[model samples]
Target chain A: MLHRIEPRSGVAFTLKRGQRLKVSDPEGEQVADLLAFNADDVDEVISSGRTLDYASRIFLTTGDPLYSNRSNVMLRLEEDRVGRHDFLLTPCSADTFRIIYGDEHPHRGCFGNLAAALAPFGIGPDRIPIAFNVFMNVTVDGATGELKVEPPRSRAGDYTVFAAEMDLIIGLTACSALQSNNYAFKPIHYEILD
Target chain B: MLHRIEPRSGVAFTLKRGQRLKVSDPEGEQVADLLAFNADDVDEVISSGRTLDYASRIFLTTGDPLYSNRSNVMLRLEEDRVGRHDFLLTPCSADTFRIIYGDEHPHRGCFGNLAAALAPFGIGPDRIPIAFNVFMNVTVDGATGELKVEPPRSRAGDYTVFAAEMDLIIGLTACSALQSNNYAFKPIHYEILD
Candidate 1:
C-alpha cells in the first residue's frame, strides 16, 4: 500500500513481520518523523538507545537491527540510499513549540499530529515516543563537539527500507516545523510491502 | 553499593525501580559504556531511540525520561552535573576494530569486555546492543551536520544519575580504545543508591 502524507500531517498503519516499510523523499530534502510500536502491546515500541546499543553503530546503515527494549528485534535496515537517517535527534513537538516559541503556536508540530493519529489507539502525549527523523541531516563537530541539525542529504527519489522483525504500528509525520529552514518542509511519500 | 570498574573491564548488576545508578569520571575525560536489559526478558533492553524519543531531546539531562522500546519508561535522569552524556553514538566494537584495524589487533575494544560480562547471562555478541556512551563528548557540526566524537568536557568528580523505571541488568565497561585521545581512557566509578 502506498500513501501520501501531506505537509504537517501524519499517517499510521501496521507493518507485519517480514514486510518492509519504505519512506521516500520523492522530491528530496524532506524529513519524516517515524514512530513505531509493537502491534499487540503498543507499549513496546522501538527504543533508540537499544537499537543503537545492539547495532553498535550511531548511524543506521543496511543490516542494522532495530531492537525493542524487551530485547525483541523489531526491524532491520534492509536498504538505505542516503545512509544518514537520524535516530539520535528528536522530532519537534507542541510542548517544544510552546516552550521554545510560546503558547501562541499550538497545533503546528509532530506532538499534535502523532497524538491525533494515535488517539484512536488511546495514546496521548505521555505515551507518544519521539520519532526517528528520517531524511534529516545532522552533524557533530569533531573539534567543538557541537551538534547541528540541517537539511536532508538525500537527492530526489532517495529512500530507506526496513524489514519488520515483528508486527508493528508505524506512524509518520510530514514534519511540523514548517517555518524552520533546518528540514525539507515538504510532503512525504510512504509505502508498505508485504 | 559502590564498585570501581577497572580499565578495559566491565561489570553487570541489577537495578530495581527508584534506584539510582551513578557513573563518575573521577579524573575526567573517561567514557563509560552503559548497557541495560529488562531483568526478566533481557531481550527487551534499554533503547537509545526510545529514551531520546520520550525525552524529546537529543542529549540526556536531569529529569529526562529514558524509555524502553516497548515505549516503557525504563529510567529517568535524576541528577546531572556535566550534562553532555551521549545517547546518540555507539560504543567502540571489536568487529568494527577488525574491519578498521585488522584481526591481528585483538582485545582492544569495548565489545570483548561487554561480551564477557554478559556471557554469563547467556548474551552473545550477536545479542549485544550498542551501549549508551556516557560522559562521552559528541558534537555535530550545525553547518555541515558532521558528527565528531571528541574528548569529554566533564571535569573530575562529575557524575550523572539515572533512576530505574523497571528492574534492569546494567552492564558497564571501561572503554578499550587504548590509542584514542577522544575519550577518557581511564577506569569508571559507579554506585547504586537505594
Candidate 2:
C-alpha cells in the first residue's frame, strides 16, 4: 500500500532488517528528508560524517550505504531515479525561515515536523541530526565552495529505494521550506516491501 | 594569561557578550574545533545551517557572523589570519576513527573530549553539533561536490579572533584526528580578551 505524506508534514515508523522502502516524488519537484536510527538505541543514530567520510563524496545514491554513528551500516540505497540529493544541508526549520527569509511568522518546518512525528518513539529535537535529503537539488560551487539550493530534477513518480540493514526507526518528511521545493509545496508517497 | 589545550583534549568556558576569543595555532598545521551555545539556554545552540544559509558560502572568515539555532547571532569573526576553515564537518569522534580509519584502538577524539569538557555545564554528546573548525583545511571538488580534508595552511602563531554576540558557553578542542592535523598532534592556544 502506498502511504501518502501531505505537504509539509512528516511520519515515523519502523522497518525490520531486509525490508525495503520506496520514497517517491508523486508530484514533481518535491523533496523529502529522511532519517534513520537504530531501534535498540537512539544514541546510535545515522551519521552523515561517517557516511561521507567513507564514501569520499557528497552525492550519495544507488549502492551507497548509510552509516550509523557507531560505524554500522543502517541502510543501502538500492535504486534511485533522481540522483541528486543533499547530505550537507540540514533540515529546514523555524529558525531557517526567521534567519534567512526574515519571515514574520515562521512555520515549525521539517525539524519541528520530525520532532513531533518522532516524539512517540522518544526522539527529542536534540537527537535529530543532519538528514539524507532525497531529491533535493543542492549545488555546490567548485571554485568558491558556496552552496545553493536548486529545484529538484525529479518528475512525477520518480523514486528511490533503500534496503534496511537492521531494525530501524525512520523519520521522513515532505520538506516544508519554500526554496527547497522551488517555492511550491507538494505531497510525497512511500511504500514498504518485504 | 593564555590558556593551553593540550593535544587531543578540550576545554569549555563561558564568554560574555562583547568579549573576544583568540584561538591560535602555536604549532603550525594544527586544527581546533569550536562550538558555542547560548549561555542562558543550552538548547539554543550554534547552528551551521543558519550561518551557511545566511552567508551563502561555506568558507567563513573575518567579518562573518556565526548564528544560533534560534536565528540569532552568537559570534562574529573579527580577525582571521588563516582564511581557510570548515563549518561542514562534525567534530571527530571514536566512531570516526572506527568507521573511517578502521582503527581497532580508537581514540575518543574531539567529540568525546568536548562532551567530557562540557558535561559540567550539563551539555551532552547529543547537544554537540557541527563545529567551526579553526585552521582546518577542507576542499571540495568543484565538479563532483566531493570533499577532501587537507593540511591546514596556518603557520606557527596564526590565529583567528571572534567577538561574542551574546553570553555564550564555548567548547574548544585540539583536534585529535591525525588526518585533520596533517598526522601530527599539537597543542592549541587561546586567550580571552575584554
Candidate 3:
C-alpha cells in the first residue's frame, strides 16, 4: 500500500492501477475539485458528457464507474460519504475571477493551482478538463428546478475514495469560491494508498 | 409531429412516449432550464444525483438519457448543437434571491416562471428538481481542475432536441439569471415536435 497526504493547496500525482486515492474535508463544509487523466495518452481523458451518457446520471456517488471520452472506464467510486460531489458546475479559475469578480479579485483560483501542479509533469492548459467537484453543496430546487451552489453538507472527517482503473495523472484543487458562503477554502486531506 | 413554440418564458406540457421536445436559443446565447416528472408519479422525478451517478457524466449531450431519482429513464437526447446545458448548477429561485445575490438583484428568475407555469398542473415546489441548464457555458480546466461559467458557445439559432421515453410532465424556464453577463435575461425559443 502506498500512502501520500497532500494538503488543501493544489496538488497532482500519479497512481498505478489498483492504487486508490482518498480525499477528505477534515474541518468539513469545504469543496474540492478533482481531475484525472490517462498517464499514457492525456488526450484520452474523463468526459462528463460521455460518462453521463453511459451511466445515465447527473450526480456521482459510490460504486459508479467514471468513464472517459471514448467510454473507457477510468476509475471506480470505491468509497464515498458526502455523496454530493459536483461533477456539474465548473471550478473557479483566475479568468473566472476576472469575469465574475473583476481583474482585481485578490484570491488565486483553482486554475492556477492545477496548472502549476501539472506544469512539473509537463501538462498544459490545452490538456486540462473540468473536475469532479467534491463535497460541494449544489442542490436543485424540488419546486422550480432551481440550482443552488451552497456549502458542503458534510461534517468534519467526511471523505470519499477513488480507485484508479489504470495509470492515472491526477489534478486536485481546494475550491476557493469564497462568495460561496464558506469562511475560507478549508484544507483538503488527500491520501493515495496501495 | 406536434409542434408548439413557447417564447422565452416558463412553459409546461405533458409529453407522451415517442414525442420529442426541442429547446432553442433562437437569437443565440440564451439558456433554458428544463425539469420533467413522471406523469404517473411525480415523486419519482428528475434526480441530478442519480442521473450523474448512472451516467458517470456531468454534462448532457446528444443521445444521453435523463433519469429519474428512481433510476427510470425519462428522456433521451436525440440531437444537440450548442452542447452545453448545466444539469449541475441550480436554477435561480425566489429564496435563492436573498441567499446568493441578496435581496437587491432585480429581474424575475426561472423559479417564478416555472412555478406559475406548473401551477395549472398542480405541481408544487416539493416536486421541482434542478433543471437541465441548456446552453449555459460551463467548462472545466482538466489540467488544473478549474471550472468556468461563461456564455454559451453557440451561434444564432442553435438548438438541442430531446425525445420523451415515457409520459413526462416538463416545465421549461427561460433562464433569467440576471447576473449571467447579458444585457438582461434574454428570451429563449422552446418548440415541441412530433
List TM-score per model, in order: 0.60, 0.93, 0.51
Model 1 reaches what TM-score against the true structure?
0.60
Interface RMSD of each: 7.0, 2.2, 17.0
Error of 1 at B47 (Å): 1.4
lDDT of 2 at B65: 95
Cα-lDDT of candidate 3: 0.69
On DockQ, who's better, 1 or 3? 1
In model 2, which regions exceed 4 Å deviation?
none
Model 2 over residues B46-89: C-alpha lDDT tens digits? 87766887787888889999987666899999999999998887
Write model 3 residue lDDT over A1-194, tens digit each, in one string: 42322333588889888999888887778877788888887666665544543343456789988866444688898999877766654456654555456667545567667778888877775445546778876654332334556778777988999999989899887777674427565777788888
Structure candidate 2, residue pairs in collision: A142-B142
Off by over 4 Å in 1: A1-194, B99-103, B178-184
| Error of model 1, residue B147, in angstroms | 1.7
* Decreasing TM-score order of the candidates: 2, 1, 3
lDDT of 2 by residue, A102-153 (tens): 8889999999999999999998887777799999988888668688889999
Q: Number of the top candidate by DockQ?
A: 2
